[model samples]
Target: MSRLYVILDVFADKALAGNPLAVVLDASGLDAAAMQRIAREFNLSETVFLLPPEDEDRKARVRIFTPQRELPFAGHPTVGAAALLGLMEAMAGKGREATFEIEEAVGAIACRTVASGKRAGRATFDLPRLPQPSGAAPDAAAVAAALGLAPGDVGFEGHAPSRFDAGNAFCFVPLAGLDALARAAADPGRWRTAFGGDLGAFLYTRETADPALAFRARMLSPGIGEDPATGSAAAAFAGAVMTFDRPADGEHLLRIGQGYEMGRPSVIELGLVVRDGALSAASIGGAAVVVAEGTLFLP
Candidate 1:
């Protein structure tokens, strides 16, 4: 048997930048084990399998997987899949813009996609779940040690270590500046002590490589190493932003810079809607470029 798949660079307008995702089209026959194996074969940050929607009203059912495990929800995959689907529709002479729903392990995600001719597109999805504190994070000193930074480089202003989940969880760590962020690296020996057993650490700084961006970030994990762009982490970080920044009751837009150090610079657009000083809604948006398409053979 064979499957159709497309490789895309999510959060990037160009090829070979941002977080690369492999999207398997019409993955109805494959089981979870097979999906996992295929994900490992692709060996990208994440791979998504598109199946027929259980609810006919939805556009598709999306299953996201890392090299090691399946994820309930993932940001880049969702964005990339939506963009690709939109491009397919456009090429079929349907339309350039589309609004649809995609079912994931977490729930139904509402997506809006704008196709750019044949090669690239932008997608935005409303978060099915709001960000919530998952658990207590390790102290700043321990986190600093795990990231190979001094204790003093751990936080900035009112930010400290915290855990949040918007389907996927991450330990959000705020660094003092870009200098500390640049120096930070995950030390395997100390990683578990700081972020616990499964949570990856999302290190961020107010200083960005691009001054136009609101923040600079890096995602490091024992399993995945460094991710060029992390949409789920950006989604979860909304909780930390609300707690610390406390934006007035209105819609706010933030641009995050990531992957510069890895030479695949990327940008993530996060929109937060606040009401009465509380986060009411949030969305993640980014551009994805289709880089390659191929057939995958399977037994």
Candidate 2:
């Protein structure tokens, strides 16, 4: 069988500068095993398979996968898929902006896309579920050890180590500064001990390469090595920001820089809606560009 696939750089305005995703547009006949195999073949940070939506009103049913396993929800794939779909629609004379819903294992995600050009667009989606604290995080010392950092480098200001889950769970570790963040590397052997399981770790610092950005971050997982940009982790980090920053009730937009260490340099926009001192809603938005398109042949 042959399937149509596209390679997109998510969270970037240009080619090869953000998290690259493989999107399988014709995934009707593929099973879970086949999808996993294809994802491994692509070997990108993540891949998405678009299927017919169970609900007719929805745009599509999106299944996200890493090289290792399938995910209920993911950030880059959702954004990239929406951008591609919206751009295609516009090129077909649909409209410049589109609004739709996409189903994932986490639930239905509401998405809005604006076509920026013939091959690029920006996409924003409301998280189906808000982030929540998953459980107690490992100690700072453990986290530091897992990330190849000193104990003193583990935290800064009101931020510390924490865990949160939006659609996926992640261990959020705050670093002291850009120097600490740059020096940090994940020691896979100590990962399980630090995060208490196979949970991925999201390391961030207030110091950013771009002054306009609010934070700089890196994500390391046992399943996927280093991600260029991580929307899901950014989604989960909303919990950390609410817990530590305590922004006043209203809408707040934050730009996060990631993938710099890998030379990809991507930006993610995180929007939080605070009401009466509590988080009511959150969104992830970014631009994506379609870099390559081709047919994938499978046995």
Candidate 3:
């Protein structure tokens, strides 16, 4: 048996508020089945297991797993995993930031780590920008019905429900008010059938309550049932709205609050810009505190 070191809590300045992740630093000799079993045992939104880099120039390879299945790309897992690997380097007396090439099912995701504190700190990786906007958009009536609301509940007369992906798929449903956002509840089975599949859904609305706050989001994922704060889906949601909402130039920062429903309220900072009729140079960053650090004994 070997010891498996793991860390949890990402995207929150303080611990225990954001998405919880389980990171396996050394995944050598663990077959796919074994990895899946471990993931099921941990039962987080996602679990990342590390593999040796194929090339010396590269960092480490990563495999992402959900309790039910494996995901090609996930935002929190990528961030948490990269930071964990960097902390490992810091532990070994390496410099503050250590870089790694995370080879996943999607592709090689280049990760860079920066020490944020006295402890081995958070690392970051800007995943390959693969935003897919399939024209198969969802209508407002159907979206409202799914959220147990009226057709008039969706925000803005023009904006329709849309699908966007930065790697993982998401449905950006903007509501008329925080009441509708908070009252959100959908039959899991019905939602799966209605939306096709749930990588992300139904971000809570806040500006309706306080105009200064652009939006408040409550994200629902069929994979984890619910995610406190979702970075990738949040990024996709921001991109989707720009096509319809059309914010003015120079307003680069979009503030979206998520996780209110889950009791672990989270905030995601999205810096975005659209250029030449296309979204480009979108940067998503948030604070993550190490809530728990422990080792797993693989017997």
Give lDDT tens digits, candidate 1, residues 194-257.
Answer: 7877588989999885778999999998777899999999999999999888999999999999
Provide the lowest-lDDT 10-residue window in model 3. 204-213
- Residue-level lDDT of model 3, residues 1-299, one tens digit each, is 76465766777666767788888878899998888998998888788898887766777888888887788877788777777777767778897777767777777777777767644356556546746784477766767777777777786546667888877778878777777787877766667655766646855454545453467888875555677878788667766667786766543766677786788866666666667655665656555556666777777
lDDT of 2 by residue, 1-299 (tens): 78899999999999989999999997898899999999999988789999999999999999998888999999999999999889888999999999999999999999999999988999999988899999997799999998899999998897999999998999999999999988998888998888999898898999886778999998888756788899999999999999999999999999999989899999999999999999999999999999999999777
Candidate 1 local distance difference test against the native: 0.92
Enumerate residue pairs that collide in model 1.
Answer: none
* Best model per lDDT: 2
TM-scores for every candidate against the unseen true structure? 0.98, 0.97, 0.87
Question: lDDT for every model?
Answer: 0.92, 0.93, 0.72
In candidate 1 the C-alpha lDDT for residue 264 amounts to 94
